[model samples]
Structures are given as structure tokens and as C-alpha cells.
Target: MSTPRYALYYAPAADSPLWHFGCATLGYDAFTGEDIAFAAPAGCNADRWPQLTAEPRRYGFHATLKAPFELAHGRSEGQLRAFAHQIAAGLSAVPLAGLAIAALGRFIALTPAGPSPALQTLAFDIVQAFEPFRAPLGAADLARRLASPLTPAQRAYLEAYGYPYVGDDFRFHMTLTGSLPQDDVAGTTAALGQAYAAAVPAAPAVIDRLALFRQDSREGRFRLLDSFMLGR
Candidate 1:
């Protein structure tokens, strides 16, 4: 069946205009301006992480609900798009409440310093609404997880929901730098911080819209295909 594929993304389209500030720091070519190339300063090379502690490995620079999934048998993209539109309408803006960069120890990511009901609601709504389209985790994906030997908690969570990251476990972040060697951490953090400051002048109010990404074939970088605005 040509290895049918689809993705359930965070729909970060509204932020796409400036998301490059976040993506570029992490070495992803944000589909914004002329594709620019950037490098990690010192500690955040990311190649050195022994396990899947890296954003690229787990979740790109995004905060996805389902991390994209192939539609199960007897499903179509048109239906998926319509379903997404419905979900977007029900969601209010994710709130521009201003975020901050935190040391996730090995990595640096943007997170809400204080609690925001808007953020939590959006996450729950996105995950639960589009879940019906999620296909069962395929063998390849499952094998990769088993290869890493899930922890007791991870295994238990997976057994129950097919994904180790969810609900109470979910944290919203826009990954900026990768985990680096202990020695290189300082310079990398400064470089990334400066980069973000230079990127967005001020935060906008109410983030609305969803982005749909499709793989060219297979083994291709996820690219922005279309964007569906919130509600309508």
C-alpha cells in the first residue's frame, strides 16, 4: 500500500513565522526565510547523548499531540484534514503568555515557567481529539523502543497507552539546544540564548492554526505541506 503515511503535528504554523529561532538553534531548517545553517557552540553537540535524550530523537523541535501517525486502514487524508479543522475550531489560542528557557539538565528547552490553563487544555484537546486517527504502533517503532529497554514506568505507560509520553508526563517545550559534553555546555547555552533574543521581538497573543506535514516518500525530512487555521 505504498507504506501509507501521515503525521499528527503540533500545528505550529502560526508560530512558523518565527519558530526558526527555536528550530535553527537545534539544527533544523525551519521553513521560514532563506534556509540558514547554524552550529552548536560548545556543549550541545547532541551527537554525544548515549540514549534517546535528544529532541531530534524523541520529538523534533515541536510539541506534538501524537507525534504524527499513519492513518489506519480504510482512512483517507481528506477525512483527516476535515477532522483536524474541527479540532482547531474547538481550540482557543494556545496563549502568548511568554515562555522561558530552562535547563532540562542535559538539554535546553522553552517551557512555561508558571502554570497556564490554556496550555494544558490545548495539549489535552489535541491529543484526545485526533487520537482516533492514530494507527497501532508498527513493529519497527516498537522494536526501536524495546531496543532501549523501557524503564518500569515507561513500560507500564506504554502497555496502557502505546506511548511512554503523555498526560501527566507531557511537558510543552520548543527544543533549542541538544545535550552537550559537560565542558561545552556554557558557551552553547549563551549562543542559543542570544539567538532566541535576536529571533522574536515580542510574543504574539493567541497562537492559532495547525500545520500538516507529509514525507516526500520515506526517509525525507518532514516538510510543511499545508496549514489549517483554527476554527473554519
Candidate 2:
């Protein structure tokens, strides 16, 4: 079997309302690697839901802190895990206050209601700190990443960090659906808003830990390997 690729993700606590709701909506649990049973949102076409959510459901419900990457030539998974532990120990949790359902490009996501500089800094720091463990992108991977038109800076970041949407380009989001057709976006957004209303926290959601996720292969589902608490 191939060594799995790993990622650092900001997953909500398993028992939290957000976790339950997000997993139910996406219909997969990254932590447990299980398909969850959930009713379709009110007024939503059940048949269309699986197709709309297919992409995000596969990735589970979490914001990416570090995109998935294979380990460098000389590194082992244990070394990467220790490094992640050290990184988490030196950092503090950031308060993610007032999440709102909003359209992010063609899809919808749970986004912070206001700017959180601390959150941005934490993400940037994680990307930089873990770069040593990340193997450089292969030719095919690089080509696939650049298949879409990217700004010059995004291309540069891709070359430097192996992922385009890192550093200053990173926008924290827990994606709720795959890219929706223009005609379907508005209705889907409203349905999701109503369905997830109870799960939205009235107060701040503390980003207290970083989760390590492992994918058995490029085509496999990512599952939680472990979680390292912040401020340890």
C-alpha cells in the first residue's frame, strides 16, 4: 500500500453542534469515515442534493489549514506528527466569531461574520511551518493545479508553497456544497441557511485544535488520523 498523504484541518469538535450539523449536511464524517443519515433540507429536491454536495462531502466538513501533501523524501509520518505537535503547542486558539452562511464564488460556505486577523495569522503560520515536511509537487500535480486560470501571485504561491490559495489568499471557509449552477445557487443557499440555522453559533467558535487527516490514495477519502490541541 502507498503511504497516505496528510493535511492539517480545522475540524469542529466532534460533539459540537456545528460538527453534527455540518456532517449531516455533507453526509460524511471525516473523523469516523462514516456516511451519516440525514433528511434533505425543507423545500430542497432530494435527488439534486447528492450531486450538489458530492465534492465537499468527499472532503468532509472542515476548513483546510494546510492542503494535503505527501511527505518529503527523508521524512516519516511520525516526524510530521511531532512537528505538528510542536507547532500546536506554540500557538494559541483563535476565536472565530459569528459564522454566517454566504456565497463564496459559485458555492456557499460558513464564513466568519467579521474579519479575524488572528485566524489568518494561524493559517499562514501553519502553512509555513509545515513546508519542510511537504514534498515538492510533481509535474502532473503542478499541471493539474494550474489547469484553471490563476493570478500571477497565485501561480507564484503555487511554486513556492505547493498550493495556490495559501498565505494572504487564504479565506477561512467550511464549504457546504460543490459548485452550484447559477440558477440553483440562490435556492440552495436559502435551504442550507434554514437547515443549519440552529447549528450556527451565536458566540465565537474557538479554533482550539489542528486535525491531521490521511488519504490512502489520490482517489481515497480522507479520514482523521489524529488531533493536536492548540496552546498545549
lDDT of 2 by residue, 1-232 (tens): 7667999999988888899989888889888999987556788888778788889887788999999899999999999989889889999999866788888889999888889999999999999999999999989889999998999989998999999998789999999898989987888888888887855556767889999988888778889888899999
Can you list the residue pairs that collide in candidate 1? 8-68, 11-211, 43-180, 43-184, 43-185, 89-231
Model 1 lDDT, full chain set: 0.59
Tens digits of lDDT, candidate 1, 94-209: 66666666667767676765677676667666767766777777788777767765677777656554566656666776666557566655665675666566666657435466
TM-score of each: 0.75, 0.96
Which candidate ranks first by lDDT, i.e. highest? Answer: 2
User: What C-alpha lDDT do the candidate models reach, one value each?
Assistant: 0.59, 0.88
How many steric overlaps does candidate 1 have? Answer: 6
